[model samples]
Target: MQALTRPYGALHCRVDGPSDAPAVIFANSLGTDLRLWDPVLPLLPHTLRYIRYDKQGHGLSTLGGGTDISDHADDAIALIESLADKPVFFVGLSIGGLIAQTVASRRPDLVRAVVLSNTAARLGTVESWQARIEAVVGHGLEHIADAVMERWFAPAFRAKPELALWRNMLTRTPAAGYIAACRALSKADQSAATAALRLPALAIAGDTDGASPAELVEATAALIPGATFHIVPGTGHLPCVENPTAYAAILSPFLKAHAHD
Candidate 1:
């Protein structure tokens, strides 16, 4: 529950494990805060230091007029610089994935590798994002919370009683903040930049993901020279939440392999 001051505003951050351990930084999805990685954190290796933070306009962080994915990446860059003294393994989900790619592209010295989960280089079209923005602005987040839940998890998970928690989180998100992130997604295209990366990369996707399907994630992985792609069965966009065990299984080995790099 720490906050790091940035040019736009302060970013709420949380760190776990040994202070001097190899660092792993997580950037969460849109609409969700740093808590998005809570389920998966305990499952990761104890030897690593894990860092998670709320992006501008999400969680307790302020928006301060950030309008693009790069703006979000700037916060990530600042966080990494302020905390970790060495390069880190960056794992990002959905919109966070876009931010990871941008950070890796711009500041390779700060990143050792990247794990992209349930996301693509380019997400929705401008018109589609504009429509979503209009819906949230005109009707509020509750209007689209149901649909977002469907995209977030598999039907089996949704049938469980715990589904209510995520739905509530989505609907409670600040309208202005969520819309600002939507505008970022609408304009972000990291295909070329991601392809240029030479660092170790892993892209994981849920087989049943509605937002960024397995095919889309695999295609994005293909852009990178040697990025490994994995598909977690029975999960949707947020596998780390739906089945943190399986997600951690896929992620743990990557962390081990790149721990010394």
Candidate 2:
């Protein structure tokens, strides 16, 4: 684990692989930390450097209250800029995808390419996000973690041992942080920004993902010219954990093909 002070707050990050290798940064979804990427990292070839960091309020990172996606994107760019001069392959899931899109749009020079997984350009109805915020703040993370876990994984995967582990992690996250993220997602609208991105991009979705349905993923892919779209079989929102091998099979090629040399 490594720590860095960015403009927004202190960021806790995990660096893997060779320092000199082409950089690939993985951003975690709302309510989860960089640990979510643990299963996918080992499957990736060692030729590239990997950076996984907790978003503000998610893991070890801390920030002032009411941080939005744009703020989060700035934090991400700051972290990457502090680490490497080279552009990086930005891999993001769910809310992370929203941040990646924001970064690519505002600071295209920092992004070599993007891998957006199990995410949407615009997530949830306003009412839904509001309800989510209320639920988390009123009841706590554990109150909604079970439902979140169900949405995160397919029915079959819910019975797996790792599902329990993920649930525990989700349940223990700070309710304030989770609610803050819900508000961020509530207001985030990247449709115009994402459509303008000309960088090489890949959008991966799970066939069973209720949060980001295949159609929505397909629509998002269509917005970006030449964006490759792949649907992971028998998985839900968190395909990186639900089906790590298959997720890697799709992601490794995307990373290799567009890696900054």
Candidate 3:
């Protein structure tokens, strides 16, 4: 694991594929880390470089104690700047998707394109997130793990033994990190800024996504002038994990057409 300690706490990162090729950077959702993209990475063409990192407090990195989405965006931008000097295709899921939009808005030059999967311009109301904050701060991450899993994956995916692995990932996350991220999502409203972005954008959705369903994701796509949108059937919020093949089918062509050189 490589380490970057600027603009945020130590960020655990990895770069794969050809070093000279165009870069693709992936950020994980809340309660998860860089491993979220593991299944999808190998399926992609190995010609382009792939960058993955655990956001501060999510994996091997320390928490920045930040409570806004911009801080998370800065972490992403910092990593890209530290590693190489070029535009990147930013792909993210859930809160990671929010970070993609935030970064594209703040620093378009650093971004070659963006793929937002199972995310939204605004996630939840202040009261709902506040209640969630209270629940986690008082009870702990395990207290809400099941609910998150239900919303994250389809019912069949939940029945498998592998679901236990994700449950552990959620339960093991530090309460402070989870709560801080929740606070950031709660306050983030990227509708205007996201609409203003003219860069190449794609919004992907899972048909069964209870957190951010296909309809909601489509709405986000409509915000961008020429953004493309696609839906992965029978999956929920985290399509990249539940059905990486289908996710790759959509993502591969987009990268080839837009970012691949």
Candidate 4:
């Protein structure tokens, strides 16, 4: 429950593994906090340090007036500079993926590689995001929690009692924070920047993800000169949650391959 204070507010952060180890930073999806990586972290090698944090207004962190993807990228850059001795492996999911792309482009020296999970260069259109914004601002997160769950997890996961936990997590997020993130998403298009990235990159997608389909993820991966891509079977948007083993299997090797670079 450590916090890094910035001009806007404090960022809730947690670090694990040895301090001298190589660093791996995780940026989770919208509507989720650092806990999004809980399942996958333990499955990864403990030799590397793991850094996780709540984006402004997502978990325990304050909003700090962030309205675009660059603002979020600023938060990540701050964390990496303060916490790690060297460049790290940056792994982002959903909206976090957009942040990873931005960070890699803006501060390539801070990142050794990037793993984009269940995301694309551009996600949704302005009109669609505007509609979603209206829905949340007018009706609240609970109004769209069910539909979000449908997009977030496979049908089998939705049927289980544990679904309530994730649903509550989504609904409990601050509306102001969520809406700010939506606004950022509406304006972000990283196609050109992503294509220009010369660092190692890995893109992972879920087979049943309705938000960012496998084909779309593959296309984004193709934009990078030598990016690798993989899909976890029978999962939805959050494969690291529904199928951490498979996600770790795909991620661990990539991290190891680039650990010393």
Q: Give residue 91's lDDT in candidate 1 (0 to 100).
A: 98
User: Residue 226 CA error for candidate 2 (Å)?
Assistant: 0.3
Better of 3 and 4 by lDDT: 4
- Please, what are the lDDT tens digits per residue for candidate 3 over residues 132-213? 9999989999899899999999998999999999999999988888888999989999999998998888899999998888
lDDT of 2: 0.87
Worst 10 residues of 2 by lDDT: 62-71
Model 4 TM-score, 2 decimals? 0.99
Ranking by TM-score: 4, 1, 3, 2
Question: What is the lDDT of every predicted structure here?
Answer: 0.93, 0.87, 0.89, 0.94
Clashing pairs in 4: none
Cα-lDDT of candidate 1? 0.93
TM-score result, candidate 2: 0.97
Stretches > 4 Å off in candidate 3: none
Between the candidate structures 1 and 3, which one is better when assessed by lDDT?
Answer: 1
Compared with the true structure, what per-residue lDDT tens digits does model 1 show for residues 162-226?
A: 89988888887788999999999999999999989999999999988989999999999999998
Sort every candidate by lDDT, greatest first: 4, 1, 3, 2
Local accuracy of candidate 4 as per-residue lDDT tens digits, 70-167: 99999999999999999999999999999999999999999999999999999999999999999998999999999999999999988989889999
Pick the winner on TM-score between candidates 2 and 3: 3
Backbone Cα, N, C clashes tallied per candidate: 0, 0, 0, 0
Residue-level error in angstroms, candidate 2, position 72: 0.7
Q: Candidate 4 at residue 89, lDDT?
A: 95
Q: What TM-score quantifies how close candidate 3 is to the native fold?
A: 0.97
Per residue, candidate 2 scores C-alpha lDDT tens digits across 1-261 of 688886556788988888888898888998899999988889998899999998888778885453578878877888789886699999999999998999999999999999888887898877999998888778888788888887899999998787888888888776777788888899999999999999899999999898888889888888999999999999999999988999999999888887754
